[model samples]
Target: MILKTSKEILREITLCDHCLGRQFGKISISTNERRGKVIRNLLNCLNPELSTNFNKQKPCFLCDNIFERAEDIVKNISPDFEFFTFHAGTKIPEEIMKKEEMLKEKYGLQYQESIKQELNRELGKDIGAIIGKEFKREKEDVTILLHPYDSKVEYVINPLFIYGRYNKLVRGIPQTKWFCTRCKGRGCAKCGNTGKMYDVSVEELISELFLKETKGADSSFHGAGREDIDVLMLGNGRPFVLEIKSPKIRDIDLQKLELEVNQINEGKVRISGLCFVEKEIVEKIKNTHMRKTYLAEIDVCLTEEEKRKIEEFFLDRDIYQETPNRVVHRRADKTRIRKVYKVLTSKENCSSLEIYCDGGLYIKELISGDEGRTNPSIAELLGKNIKCVLLNVISIEEKV
Candidate 1:
């Protein structure tokens, strides 16, 4: 059957050893080129009259003898960036693919492999050996794509993700860069030519250092949840992931970088528990909801009885809140239901209270009532005007 198939195929169109063997790639463990050579020799011996057609004097109809120039194709790839693992891909011309498909259909070849697949494997093996990098199919640090016919090569460098917790020690700074509403990040007189609403942010403080250390092109910050500009993230801090794009260096010492960042940002922002993480952790950090404890200092002083009543009122209580007026312009004006688990009064200050609540509860609105947007608030319950003068997130429960 093999000799008969080879005789008919060679009579129809010329093929190189590599292309000929790929038609029956799944048949044996030998390389396709070797298989093609053996099949051609056997066919020539059996039928001496067809030996002239089996000559390799012409380009292959399927691949145009691409396998013959595999070494030259790999020579065009020279990656400047560092990568430990990589995968190879090829962009074959449409005509070549169609021709290969037509031959497979005409012969009913079930064990055939596509030209792209064979090219990718051959190129990957050669490139990996030449560069001293492992060839990986899944989660490779980089991918090399070759447009073999066009003589073009492209590189895709995957982003690196780092997970850690951060503390916003000082207030009056946004979690991320806040662009000027008037100029929309373009420099203008209203923004004093800075193009931003604030001079610095937690994201800039943390990401700038990592980008410099890794020699990355750009970066993005993903926090589990953010706090208001006037609020401080104290205690253990909040969970976050920093994604660095096109990092030339991946084997970074997280401990050394963490120490450097904390020292530079000192009183402004600090990060801890810095470690390498996969990209999937960013989604989990954003989606998972954990309980948070906040300490709020109110403007009005409350008596012992008033404090006791306030604590008793908020125990496992569900509070309905419309988006606060301050942030309604940027956010959707929708109502959210959150639960307050417990409330405790501070011994040092009669006006201060510590509230333990769900992740999304609006603490400031819960205190001031947001002009009836938040139901059963401290201001409404006590029949007195109240305002949260100072707020601090004391703790955030870690993901289980």
Candidate 2:
């Protein structure tokens, strides 16, 4: 009785083999098309009257024979990609879905999968067989979008992240590239028509080398903190990340690349501890609250007694530093409280001091007192004039 009723239902409606088979998809570990054939064969054995009509009728009341176009789409996509893994997805029309749901409810097929899911799986199987590649649901290199109008292939290139520490060996070099003041990167005689204030920068040196190695289009530089153009970075160097955009090649020899960069920029800039990283490292490094150590050589018009007192004054004290006049044009005029952990003075050559403070503390202002803008500064403590002639970032603590 069940077999006779199924045959009557098949004869009544216009269902393609795929959709008809999907009505019984959960019966066995077989394809919907195969199940449809099996069901039709069973119906024929049970009922001889409707055998000829069952073999002749061919239509799908739900999809309207859309599955027949899967072959054409597969052929069009076979030569479109050269990727290790891919996934095929479909965007079915609302009307087709409504018809499918209507049929599912009418036939009480609550356990069967949707038409779109089956189509995507079937298409992926066919394409995978031809291309000899596995299907990746997540982190795919390429995705094939199948629509009623056309099929489109999109390559999903993952961004490459590299984390390391860099040393700006020489002075008068900015962390990132600076455009020329005269032409503003448009090129002018005042800047030697190079459109740059400096011939090279830390970003340029590291980014160019990375771009070459990865065959990437471009890159973005993220540093834990920035140092002035005249400040040299020393010690274990400063942490940074290089985000490569649209890299064609991902597997790279980081150690060899690091060696090449250090060799090329021998005395200018150098990077160490090069390693492949994920995107999350960039944000974590940027928002770090690591302590900083700076070595500043200053010229103070103070006696030995005053210098001694000034060095001991900044130890374990809080400074209310307002925005310095020099950077007031760009930075907001506001006050910020910073902590000074230690201040060590050295009178060997030109009166230098190693100042350790919380991150984001303006060391230059601390020495100059920014004309009394910064309270309890070295100048304020000594009650005399002081100027930071040369500054060097000695070390930065790791926070990420």
Candidate 3:
């Protein structure tokens, strides 16, 4: 620090408060402003004081004159951004950093700090004070941007996520609207340019309404698992997360979203226990299959008396199921052994029964016996064939 004079330094290099201060970064500096001031003050004190006090205003090379207007930049952008927390994203002119490196060759520059870190600290502190929001570094909902030269700042707001559970009361429509398989959503004659197999889906009904109400451009829906279009999902529904892209309003009532979504679906789908959540929860819900219960109306080809044997197999049994023929296209033809958690006879005379157990259990294959793919199935145990007439997801259980 004592090796160079202010006039010599200013003559050799032009440095802003941040750039000059950063050169002494390893000096156990407390704050960016303090470091900037100290570095300049060292030059002023160590060297003879300037006649016109121009040394005090020596511009930072890396940050240009950005440090001179740090407070003004933070103040200018705070009005538009109103969040409980914020973080700064700094951008330094690349040439300025390079120039500092070149000057370091001739003069002794030690313990330096980066102009970017300085701007981040100074702007973050000043903005945090002006608005009572904390600087959330980990998962900030809003980010503050500073253009130190022109004292310009911009704010970026993160997307909002809402979590909820949905129950599909009726069938026929898919969990998510299906794109036309023939056109692959490109809108051929089959899809009529709508590019979908159906007009709308349970997901669309809820997400569309959310986008409208929240003034959001788009919304994405994520569920724990999806049931087939023909299958109905019941009981505690399914955990889902809906991300509102560029949400203009975050204070909307969840109860209202639930009501509006359910109403739009016309009772076709029901939602409950809705709440706002962080984006990370969506991932948890997607992978957590937990446990599920299914109720299927089995159509037995057996006589009434032979159907009675179905109960005996359910008392205690393990069923080996190869991926069913229907899903074989997507899933590998591998065998899986699952236990029957419980069984309830819906109609003894009709030879139909309900089975409850873990999720991902193939119900139709269990009844038809999956062409001998499923061992110890109701059809196999009774020594007669059976088919599932109506399959319904009765409930899904997760750790609340």
Candidate 4:
């Protein structure tokens, strides 16, 4: 059956050793090139009528003899970036793929391997050996795409993710870059030709130094949660991930960079516990809702009886909040149920209170009630008109 099939396939079309062996790939543990050679030798001995066809020196009808120049194709590729692991892919010509498919369908070849799979494996091996890098299927630092027909090579450099905690010591800056609403990032008089609403953000203050060191194309800032412009992030700080895209250098000293960033930003913004992380950490940081501790200074002075009532009333209580009037225009007008873990009164200041609650609860609305938008608020409980003069995030509990 094998000899009969080979005789018929060879008579119809010319296939190189690699292409011929790939058709019966599942039948043996050996390579397709070796299998092709063995089958051809057997046919030459058993059938002399097809012997002249073997020495015709014709290009493969399937691959056009691209496999013969595998070494030359991979040797020409030189990646300038630093990477430890790489993955390879090929963009085979559509005409070649169609021809191979037609042959498989006509012969009813069930044990065939795709041209793409063989090219990826064979080219990946040669690329790894030539460049002195390991070939990886998952989490590769870089990807090399080989265009066999065009003799062109393309490289995709994966983004580098860095995890750390940041303290926004000073207020009046957004967590991320806010483009000018009128111009939308294009320079105009509205943004003083800077194309931004604010002069600097927590993202710019931190990511600028990283982009400079790594020589990355661009960056993205992913914080656990963002604080308002006026609110200060104190104590242990907030967790964030900085994604640097197409980085030319990855082996950066995080400890050294952290120190330099803190010194440059000074009292305005500071980062700590800087370390390298995978891309998965970004999603984890964004998805996990953490409990936060806050210190809010209110306008109304709380009496002794009122202070005691406020603390007891908020313990383990659920607060229903619609999107506050201030942010309803930008955010969806939906109600969110959040839990208040604990509430405490300040020892020296009668107008100050410390609130411990879930991450997304609006502390300002909790104090003022946002004109009845938030239920069971401090103002509603005390039956007075209260306003939060200032708010500060003291700490955030890390996820277990």
Instruction: Give the number of the best model, judged by lDDT.
Output: 4
**Which model, 1 or 4, shows the larger lDDT?**
4
Tell me which residue pairs clash in candidate 4.
none
Across 78-187, the per-residue lDDT of candidate 1 in tens digits comes to 88888899888998889999998999999878888888989998888888888889888878999899988877899999999999999999999999999999999999
Tell me model 4's lDDT, rounded to 2 decimals: 0.91
lDDT of 1: 0.91
Predictions: Cα RMSD each: 2.1, 4.8, 3.4, 1.3
Model 1 C-alpha RMSD vs. true structure (Å) is: 2.1
Q: Between prediction 1 and prediction 2, which has the larger TM-score? A: 1
Off by over 4 Å in 2: 1-151, 180-195, 301-303, 332-335, 347-350
What would the TM-score be for candidate 3 when compared with the true structure? 0.85
TM-score of 4: 0.97
Model 3 regions lying over 4 Å from their true place: 1-11, 36-58, 75-83, 100-110, 149-155, 301-308, 315-320, 331-337, 347-349, 398-400
Which sections of candidate 1 miss by over 4 Å?
A: 1-5, 26-30
CA lDDT of 272 in candidate 3?
88
* Best prediction by TM-score: 4
Model 3: per-residue lDDT, tens digit, 1-400?
A: 3325334666666655555556666677466556656656665675554521235465554555776676777676744523566787766677866876666665666556556666677777887888777888767777778776555666677778888888888879888878898998989999889999998788887788787777776778888878888899888788888888766666687887788777777768888888888888988877655577787776554555654566655864677788888889977988877777767665534655668765667888777887887886777777666788888887888663
> lDDT per residue, candidate 2, 1-400, as tens digits?
3354467567678667687778767766788888777777787776677752344345567766777777776776643323566677877889888887876677677556688888888777888887777788876655667674356544555567899999999998899888998899999999999999999889999889889877787898999989999999998899999998877777789999999999999999989998878688998888876799999888854566765786677788999999998989978999999899988876664487889998888999998889889987887777778899899989999656
| Candidate 1 TM-score, C-alpha based | 0.93
Q: Which stretches of candidate 4 lie over 4 Å from their true place?
A: none
lDDT of 4 at 342: 90
Residue pairs in steric clash, candidate 1? none
Error of 4 at 82 (Å): 1.0
lDDT of 4 at 190: 87
Alpha carbon lDDT at 84, candidate 4 = 89
